[model samples]
Target chain A: MEEWTVKVEQSDNKKEKPDTEQLEFGRSFTDHMFVMDYSEPVGWHDARIVPYQPLTIEPSAMAFHYGQSVFEGMKAYHAQNGDIQLFRPDKNLARLNHSNDRLCIPPIDEEFVLKAIKQLVYMDKEWIPKAEGTSLYIRPFIISTEPYLGVAPSHHYKLIVILSPVGAYYKEGINPVKIAVENHYVRAVKGGTGEAKTGGNYASSLKAQEVVGKQGYSQVLWLDGVEKKYIEEVGSMNVFFKINGEVVTPALNGSILSGITRDSVIEMLKYWDIPVSERRISMEELYQAYLDGQLEEAFGTGTAAVISPIGELAWEGKKIHVNEGEIGNVAKRLYDTMSGIQYGKVEDPFGWIVKVKEAAPVK
Target chain B: MEEWTVKVEQSDNKKEKPDTEQLEFGRSFTDHMFVMDYSEPVGWHDARIVPYQPLTIEPSAMAFHYGQSVFEGMKAYHAQNGDIQLFRPDKNLARLNHSNDRLCIPPIDEEFVLKAIKQLVYMDKEWIPKAEGTSLYIRPFIISTEPYLGVAPSHHYKLIVILSPVGAYYKEGINPVKIAVENHYVRAVKGGTGEAKTGGNYASSLKAQEVVGKQGYSQVLWLDGVEKKYIEEVGSMNVFFKINGEVVTPALNGSILSGITRDSVIEMLKYWDIPVSERRISMEELYQAYLDGQLEEAFGTGTAAVISPIGELAWEGKKIHVNEGEIGNVAKRLYDTMSGIQYGKVEDPFGWIVKVKEAAPVK
Candidate 1:
């Protein structure tokens, strides 16, 4: 793999880090960021870590007008032994490339990017809060920088990575959330951008999400865009259901995002010899299971919340309180185990963690 | 409606206007651009026309990360009699607000926005090319400026309008082009952001477009996301067909943009007492019409390419030559009438043209 040359420029005045206990998601940022530029003929070049600051882009840049942008969400954790680690960093980079392919953006060398990310994370190691459930949130994104307005793939692009100190997703840890079954708005469809980690998928979900939020729901449980029957995803996270001690999740239908956490959960369930199946679970079938008292637990998995337990599902004004509006046993166990491995407190049977290291000796 | 307070800062250095004959679309901007900002509590304010330059946005701005951006495309014509005019500016603003609503961005007052656009266009009237089939392209866009990574409605937004000198959309005059029916990629679904003029819809079409471009097609004719049978809009324009002496275009099924030019064409057809139907026309049905020798003409409508005559369609490796690969009478007539009215060469039967007035004598 071609290595990206790392050039570091430290910030003269670093902002004081926020209180870890009061840290909100994506609000406060670290002192520096990483960026790489791509143009036709020459692929990604000039990879460097510089002071985190506003970027100047032409108003006619393709990213602003065409939405040719993709991003990945992951975190860097301060492990128990003073070692900074990343949970499935390779997976995140792979997914980012998946989105880049779908968006027609140029791909980056995974190994080189991994090294850059590790070096950047190490440079801002102090930003990783030591508090429980707190970590330095890493956002690696690419936007088309070409200033042409025609609706074609851009000839120039910029890949950027910024770090933010984020607290726990939920202030009250492990609490359940209410999700409204989305029927009026569709997030994505087969042969659509649903599977890619692109900004359009998230932009398309804002309306339904806003409506559900106004209706006193925390998130919208999206169904298949075609049939509007089978479950797809929960907001930005992949969903799973434990019905009568058997776990079932909506299979990867090319319209659902392939989440890293979802894959980990499936692997962990199989490792534990738990009955887990990856197949289509229709909303009607799930409701029937709930009526039969077979539905045990439901949760969403992502890098942000890790595991967001679905307490209540509102469908057509009919509500079903999952596990009597409490966090299910499977949800708690999965969260504990996943996060435990992430924070380096538990055994890593799958070897998902990657320790951060200095890319080169400091000058 | 609140009137926007226009503050003007003239550019110290103005770029030389490109030759009208060789002017490319959206590549060269005029001297000044308009901008407005919006916050949660304080709505849109400080409307100003400043020098056209790059905009600096935070790396974590929601628009860059999650694609919370919407835009509208229109044009300002340089009339023969030293006058500049906009065709249906109100319609564009109304549609812009519609996109804003769908994307969860705060809505703008249509009347006020139209006024702002008129003032900006009037200030940059010298950029409007006077040569045949050339004009100043007006791009009005809104982007989420809130520096956060969460996927929801943004608390801050920026509304901007920029002008670019553009020549004819088709360099070879009003010639016909071929289209490939897209089945591998779907642009929009029933409950998706298809109807809105958002960036995501355009972004999602780039990959398919790139493939078809290599296949020697000018555009991709998208089908419905669910069945992939019924015709949707072209990625850039809305489509229309003449079958059995009647004009038919896809109905506003929430998955196709309600194009202003498409609306104008419908109204023009109605005014001429021509049979025009807004209904679903399946690809199979269109192919059957072609087989029966009843399919007379096919064309696309949009502001950029006012009328794009589709000369041929390639479906499943079978090609159907349309109108003997020539511009049909209906398409020629529509393009002539639309551009004629736009350039002040024909009578404006409807009050669609908004003549630009000088903006309070620039200081």
Candidate 2:
């Protein structure tokens, strides 16, 4: 690996890390940050990990209006032996570039970003939450900053990595979340930036999410745009269901994001001798299986909450309870196994863990 | 309308407005800008028109990532007898607020925004091109500036209005453009941010536009996400076509922007005693109309370019040429009439033109 010097500006106020329970999702931050800029004339340059501070950017930055920004969400976990570990960060690096490509921003070498992130994590190791379900969340993003006022791709960009110490995702306990079937709105489409974790997809989803929030639903299950018939995803997570005792998730359609945790759950479920298949599992099929007593589980997977089981699915003026509002058997098994491996409580079999080294004194 | 404290800053090194024919789109700016900031606790404040300078923004601003931004594009034309005029700027202000409401950003008082824009345009009256086919382009935008990394709305926003002296949109000539019917890529889906003039909708359309450019096409004729059959608007312009002496365009679907120029053209066509209808236009239906030789004219409407006629349509493994690669009659008439009203050369029958006031010293 190419080693880069991390020029640090230590904060004058040496505040200790707060208790894990007191941490908010995105409010608290790690000490240091990583940043690199890309210009048409000059490629990516000025790689640094400095004290986290407000960025002095121009107001006309293209990302502000054109939405020419892409980001990845991944976490570092606290292990039993006081070590920090990352789960398949390579996947996130690849996805970031893929998003950059989709958004027309200049691409960055994935390895370079990964190195920058690993350095920040190591320097801010003390900020990592030590509780059972807490970890330091790392956000890697690239934004266009070209000052020109046009609708074309920006010639300049900024690649930044920031870390925040987040509490357990579901603050109120692991109660199953209820999802409303969104027939009126759609999140992504073929040849769209949906598969790429760009900000536009999330922004476009806010209105529908707001409407569902008023109805007491936790999240939304988006349908296909044209027909409004096919199943897509659960807002920020990839959805899955167990029908006829077999695991099922919507396939890698161009519109849905290929989530990292979604992939891991499938692998873990298969490792435990459970059947798994990636296909276009329709809502009609899930509803039919639920009616026939064949549907045993329904859940969603993403980086924040590893695997969240759905307690109820409401659609078209009707509500359908799944698994009688109890956590499904497969949901629990997959969540435990994945969490165990991530937190270093289980035996390392597939070797998905990558350890971070302590910050060395100026290399 | 509430009067704002205008803080005018004069620039000593102002460049002379380039020759009307030599002006390039979005490459030149005027001497001043209008700006206001919004905070959650305090309403909008410090509304002023200052000298054009690099804006100071926080690096972690939400507009750099979540696409929490929206904008309006209009033009100030230098009419005959040296009177500066704006065409339906009130409509742009209304649309900008609509976009803000969708993105969950605080709405700008339309009258305040209009006054700010009027002050800036009037201050830079010399920048409005005097040539026949050129004008001063106005860009009014708002972006989230809160330096936080959260998924929800931002607490701080900057509302800004900037001006640019722009030449003709189609540099090659007033010739018709060739567009490709994109079968795979989807720009905006049903229930998406297509109707809003937000940054994310434009950002989502860039990749497909890139592909269209690579394939030597001027724009992408987007289709519905699910069926991939219904025709949406062109990348930034609303599309219209003449079939058997009747003008038709896509209806105001939730997934498409209701363009200002398009609305004006519909009104003008009706005023000229020509039939016009806004309805859902399908790709198959358009193709059939072209094959039957009933498609007499094809054009796109937007603020940047009043009406750009379409020469050829490439879809279904074929190229459907319109009227032997020449500008259509309706498109030319619509363009001429609109420009005439804007430039004060025609009778002001519709009363659509609004005159801007001369600048005054700030109190």
- Write model 2 residue lDDT over A210-257, tens digit each, in one string: 889999998999886656777889968999998888999888888889
Q: Per-prediction DockQ scores?
A: 0.88, 0.64
Best by DockQ: 1
Error of 2 at B10 (Å): 5.4
Write down the TM-score of model 2's second chain.
0.95
Query: Residue A73 in model 1: shift from native, Å?
Result: 0.6
For candidate 2, write residues B1-363 as lDDT tens digits.
134666767778787767777788777788888888888688788788777877776556777667788988899988897888999889999999899888787888887678778888988888888766788989889988887777767899989888889886766678888999889877787677888988888888888889889988888888877678888887689999999999999888788898999899999989888999988778888889988999999988988878988888999898889988899899998988888898898877887888998656433
Interface RMSDs of the predictions, in order, are 0.6, 1.8
**lDDT of model 2 at position B14:** 82
Tens digits of lDDT, candidate 1, B43-81: 988788999999999999999989999999999998878
Residue by residue across A1-363, what tens digits does model 1's lDDT show? Answer: 144478889999999999888898999899999999999787888888999999999999999999999999999999989889899999999999999999999898887888888888998998999988889999999999999998889999999999999997766767899999999999999988999999888988998988989989999999999999999999899999999999999999999999999999999999999999999989999999999999999999999999999999999878978998899988899999999998899989898999997657322
| Per-prediction TM-score | 0.98, 0.94
| Per-residue lDDT of A63 in model 2 | 79
Cα lDDT computed for each candidate against the true fold: 0.91, 0.83
* Deviation in Å, model 2, residue A353 alpha carbon: 0.9
